[model samples]
Target: MAYAIRPFRKHDAAALADLTLAAIRSLGAERYSDEQVAAWASRHGTADRFVVRAATGDAIFVASDADDRPVAYALVGMRGKEVGHVDMLYCHPDHARKGLADELLAQVEHHCRAHKVTRLFTEASELARGPFERAGYTVTHRRDFAIPHEGREVAIHNYAMEKPLT
Candidate 1:
């Protein structure tokens, strides 16, 4: 399916949050307890919060359909001197593997380059490592831990990946 890539808008916050939660659940729930997942969702999935975050100059890009409904997104920002972070990147489950993620990443890379960012980093779940690696991010470390979920703790591991964009 064809999708339009554009700057994320304040009105897109709710949809963005929903998309993020859905993508995380679809890809990482096995490693997260229900409570932990719920807690994280509650904290980060609010539309208003996303609006505020995006309004502050954080570069957010969204992929939408003809109707302007968002189907995928990527959030990127500079964290420090020469360091850019991929805060998040998600595509609707139905839209997976269609190159939306790549498009989003490209946007982020462009943003980083514009800012003269020399390093780009992101934490990738097991399912995401392959794609990030293919995109030229090298795995720097892997860490395992338990996250609080619905009623218990769940085990999960994440790979810290980085790419030199300079």
Candidate 2:
């Protein structure tokens, strides 16, 4: 079934939180340890955080499944005045590999084009790198980030990718 893409609503916060963790935990295994995925998902802080950030941006898009539940989401926002960043993109595990990410990314690119953004970038997770690369994004570098998990700091790795839109 085709997904329904829309701007994020306040009611989506709780569902987005759940989707985020499910997506990461199930799909991140190829590139990260279970502990790393856990740490990354926990960094979301709270559902309120997602709601606030989604509202702050002009291009927070969520894709709903046939049941009208959010299955995937993407955020494309200005880093300055000319650059767009893909801050987050995730597909619920149940819907993985169904092209939800590509659809969400297409929405992000639409926002960038409409806003005159010359370039778009993201720190992409392992599972996300493939789609970005296929869509013409290049990896500028690989980086490791530390996040707090349980009582200690855990490291997660990602690729810094960029695509020139202009």
Candidate 3:
């Protein structure tokens, strides 16, 4: 199947929201409890927020299908001239392992470099650790934290990783 990568459009916000939830609920379910998954994925359902975020200066890339609907997306934020953060990366399960994420990750680094970003960082979920490591990012540390959700707390652990673009 052929996939296309492009800058995210405002209309893509809803699709990205759906894709985010699906990816989390399915791919993240193995290591996360139901409450944790819900707490995490629930925010992706905020359509307006994602749309506004797409318009932010951040480089938000979406991988689309032949029909032009997004199947995967990655959001990277710039803190200054030298620091970039990979904030979110998700692929629909149906599109998993088909190289869409690989393309997105490469595009992220390319975008960051073009903007003079020399250090790329990401807080990668358990499932995302291997791929980020394979892409030359090293784990700086791992943190366990709780996210307050629906009047309760949900526990999660993720790795802080970095790759030097220099």
Candidate 4:
């Protein structure tokens, strides 16, 4: 299906949050245990989080369905005007593998270029590593961390990837 890539809107926050949870629960299960996936998904449980991130100067793009609802999104946090970190990239499971993410990333790269950003990076989950690599990002290292879940720390890992925007 063809999806439209556009700048994020305030009303899309809740849908984006839902998309994040669904994507993580479904796709993350392939690479992470149930507990780890749950832990990761919890961090995105609030729509206000996206609002705060955008208010803090992050650039966010959304891929919308025909009805103009968000099915995917990409958020980039700029660092000192020369670097950007892809803080989040999520697509609803129903829309997976449809090139929506690639389109959003391309839009992000275009935004970064206009702002003179020379580097873009992300800590990509296993499910996202291949897509990021295919998007021309190189894996710099593996990031291992733990998140609090049900009173314990759940272990998780992801790849640190970067691409030169120059």
Model 3 earns a TM-score of: 0.93
Question: What total of clashing residue pairs does each candidate reach?
Answer: 7, 0, 0, 0
Off by over 4 Å in 1: 29-43, 79-83
lDDT of 3: 0.86
The sequence of per-residue lDDT tens digits that candidate 4 reaches over residues 38-100 is 999888768998888787788899999998889999999965542589989999999998888
**79-111: candidate 2 lDDT, tens digit per residue:** 554258888898888888988788888888888
TM-score of each: 0.85, 0.90, 0.93, 0.95
Off by over 4 Å in 3: 79-83
lDDT of 1 by residue, 63-139 (tens): 99888999999887755432587877778776777888888888888888888888888988765677688778999
Q: What's the CA RMSD for each of the models? A: 2.6, 1.9, 1.7, 1.5
In candidate 1, clashing pairs total: 7
- Candidate lDDT (C-alpha), each: 0.77, 0.83, 0.86, 0.89
- For residues 1-166, write the lDDT of model 3, one tens digit per residue: 9999999898998898888889999998977888889888865676686666555577789999999999999888865542588988899988988888888999999998898888999999987887788788999999899888888887888999999999
Q: List the residue pairs that clash in candidate 1.
A: 34-149, 34-150, 35-149, 35-150, 36-148, 36-149, 36-150
Number of the candidate with higher TM-score, 1 or 4: 4
Report the alpha-carbon TM-score of model 4 versus the true structure: 0.95
On lDDT, who's better, 3 or 4? 4
User: Which candidate number would show the highest lDDT if scored against the true structure?
Assistant: 4
Candidate ordering by TM-score (highest first): 4, 3, 2, 1
Give lDDT: candidate 1, residue 105: 84
